[model samples]
Target: MDVWEKCRSWTASQLQETGQDCYYQVISDTFDGTEVTFADRRIVMAASHDYLGLSADQRVREAAMAAVRRFGTSLGGSRAISGSLRLHEQLEEQLAQFLGQESAAVLPSGYQANLMLAPLLDKDDYVFSDLSNHASLDEVIRLGEAKERKFLHSNMKHLEELLTTTRAGAGKTILSDGIFSVEGDICDLPALTQLAGRHSAYVVLDSSHDLGVLGPKGAGAAEHYGVQPLLITSALSKSLASVGGVIAGPAEVIRYLRFHARTSLFTAAASPANVAAALAALEILQTEPERRQRVLNLAERLHNGLRALGYDTGASTTPVVPVLVRGRERCLRMWRKLCEAGVFTAPMTYPGVRAGREVLRVTLTAAHTDTQLERLLNAFEAVGLAEGVLPEAGPPREYAPVRITRPTMATSTARGEEP
Candidate 1:
């Protein structure tokens, strides 16, 4: 407790001195799909996870409105109590079918879905997880009190060694993210499944960022690899452009979780609007294949452009492109510069990635136009060269280049200097 208190104080004081928020804080006055307004300024929205841009779609909006008119706002209780609605049932059925699973259960959020499912494994069972898995998955493994081992991020050799050393007859479960949120690297599901088969382990995949963004029909990594995991969990907030979490798996497992998972049994059912919006999003995902391709194409262009500018975008083949910056100071400065350039992106520093591997996490979406992409690239080039992260684009122009500064507590007040 004393250490935690000191740590909290240290972080707060450091951020105060540096004029940094714990995470980048943007007070957006308005946002559609392509751009977000921060008070009087509009920034091209390159930091959003709304991959398919269905969040602002008229059809999805209309579906939510209709559901609200019919069912009011919420179901008013947990599903175990009075909260279960036909909409919830309908969404689950749709999800199960979409993922090619036997059944599905929708939860309040993606975090809760992992939280509820992870503890179902017995305390004596052995669980193996990737070090880079979502925090919720790690939390639930702790909650379950199961004997768990964490392998190095995506290191199959380390995983294999751990699997070999586990108690011979103990139940084994493998936990991993389908698409790592920060770095945007994909899980090698085919390789993971092969390893799971050898060890007889049940694989739990968090497809939160993959569904509606991968595979021929957007069924996610499982379909992309032509393999299925024992359990698949995802959030409806990302590509679905709605809100809620869902787990799709065997009917028996879902039935057991329906009653036993505390998060599901205690939390209120998903609101009418969210459920209906998710249903509509799912429909759009199937019908509008172009949305998926558009985002991917934009992502490729962004990735190629960043690499051309000589920025380190670690292992990403997805919409989540991370421009790696070396230290905290440079990373923060880079973020501030990009913000000044009217482009918004998320910055990852200590405890998110390793100490020195800070990155500016840029997310791409289908709604971004070619002109917007060009603007983004130009901003990156300007900032990258200014920060000495990239070489000069041309052979040294004679004119003076403008200087940008990351605001500190002492520098924050007078001119509305952005951090």
Candidate 2:
């Protein structure tokens, strides 16, 4: 009956004691986009979110260092108060233009970027969201206290059916993740926006995993679909190699959110170094479009290689590849084996994904060379074969999504093992 009661059961002591903990607060000695040194060993990294691999770039490092010198690291206040820098203004303006939006408001993180949408929803508003949309969108609706209706993942027919329940005059909003991180599938943005238009509902697209990674110009899902959403929110941490988030839309709409959204007005502004890092990364993203293409090509290669080896990589067309694993225990065992084989990948369970829908999260970045990628595939094959994740001694075989059979290993879902 105490406040600390719940946290008592959240400990990972059992997993650690049993040596079943493959990842949870594990220390990394050093990470340079593609390689991560940890546990006294250097391994090829396939778990980083830095999709364009700009984090370790000397140019990005220099930009961050220069900003630290100029702005003294922290700004100490919210952007609306004493924290707004000329650099912040420049970044916002440049981002808006790059994304083909009228204006942008920067936030401390992508989580806050989505939470700020709370102010846009009202009690009477009907919030239609995809089942697999990022957790932040769900929290925003809860905070907004709107009528929530979750349709199946990327199923527009279900979305339209829900829209039919609401009147045209109702205050309705459609929420979705441009790229669903768990399964590595792009959203049905074209169908979503069209449905919203018919119902006169506003659309909010969370492109946290899509920005600087998808679209013709890398402007994200909306740009790829040739349709415009009422607003787009994304993280700068991934492709931009920085630690913050941004929401872009029409000028007046952005201005309204800037003033009304407490998530932005109350939170301390993003650090100067982080903002500068994102701005510099953005510049590189635009000037060197080849990096974008290279990363996608590397991802498709990895995806094809895994599928050819008879693993189920569900409907992925992007760099985020989720190799669906079976049980929590077996998943950790496979991860440990891959580590022994000199590779590192992320482990996702329960809250990170659905309880039964566990996976070993593998990511591809432009920083990874073809040699390193091949090494990763070799490691996966070895661990997968040893773990009975794939058919033994089979001539390189291809498996369809539904055809791949996932074998469940007996065990537990460790505490705090969230993606």
Candidate 3:
């Protein structure tokens, strides 16, 4: 049999032949932050990670353009070799301050930032991770030489059990996402950090989806929980409106990773334009509180709207909202119909989720107008009713929106002390 036989006979190809594949189709966006054009039709963009809606902002665009004009695109080499720039250092310093960390190190991507931990670990170490964390965090555990254990998703009781009975290692680390992307759920960060402290395990919060959309100050999950982990990792591509990622923590750890980790030493430096744009977006995220506020307000709007429309929006408290469709084929059909109705969404299936927990992942931005949201809701109402995803929806019998609370008290850290 040909080694390529399985690739040639994949199920996705069949879905593509019938135009049911929704994953990689081109957007041909009109450059507006809130909408996209596809097949000559304008659609409200309900599935995107630009939480603060700064990716298409004119100020961000101008910063990117100015950087490109001055530095030309690529940095030409890795930072350890010849690509280190003063701008990179400046961004790191600013990020350190913003994240309440002593230091920060930038990487080529969030995936790279997640991978940074692997080089710092050994056979004597172990990592306990959430089963529902982002894929990048999952890869860190899977590829690392350290023994890895998966606790139940957000079950602090289960995590404590694993930490107590699992092999007593030379070192222990807990890995989790600030926002569990697929489930649209926020991690019980306070509980997780408390467990980490009791176990004397280091904590790593992967804040890929929450950097600019959570916390009163927009410092992601650490800030949200009033705790500082051993490290916090996040991507600029999501909220900072640019490419690349950063790991923020103590000065010693950042220094160690900068020199030892192949993620920073071997990978080419991020382009000047992307870095500058991210710096500018970070400035916006810091100064403009309204943007992140708008994101949460809009998220509440969408989440409550979906719940009232008789759809199961499972445990979402952030901008990432997942509307459960239950069946693979039904989920695909819902996505297709939503797209046809000028509303775009992401479809989650078996490998991305569990066997029966398929959903249409819907995300909103600060840039989306009320009319756009209403339009999206209307599309849902129409398609949901037509597809039997909804049954006689005027309002759900009981609708309870998740309320976000800002707890000012600090939680436990790696050493069982407040940072």
Which numbered prediction scores highest in lDDT against the true structure? Answer: 3
Poorest lDDT segment (10 consecutive residues) of candidate 2: 410-419
Better of 1 and 3 by TM-score: 3
Report the C-alpha lDDT of model 2 over 1-419, residue by residue, as the tens digit.
Answer: 99998878766886564334654646577567788776778888888889899999999999999999988979898888875999998999998887778899889899999988888888888999999988888889888968999999999999999999787677888999988888888898767877887888888888988888776667777776666788889989899999999999889989988998889999999999999999999999988878888888888788878888888788767888999886777777887888889888888776677767878989979889999989999998888888887889862654553321111231321111111
> Any runs in candidate 3 off by more than 4 Å, and if so which?
11-20, 404-419
Q: What residue pairs are clashing in model 1?
A: none
Q: How well does candidate 2 score on lDDT at residue 174?
A: 91
Query: Which stretches in model 1 have alpha-carbon errors above 4 Å?
Result: 1-12, 17-24, 393-419
lDDT of 3 by residue, 301-365 (tens): 88888888898888877788999888888888888899999898988886688778898999988
Provide the TM-score for each candidate, comma-separated: 0.90, 0.92, 0.94
> Cα deviation in Å at residue 370, candidate 3?
0.5
In lDDT terms, how accurate is model 3?
0.84
How many backbone clashes can be found in candidate 1? 0
Q: Quick one: RMSD of model 1?
A: 10.8
Residue 41, candidate 3: alpha-carbon lDDT:
94
* Candidate achieving higher lDDT, 1 or 3: 3
- Among these predicted structures, which one has the highest TM-score? 3
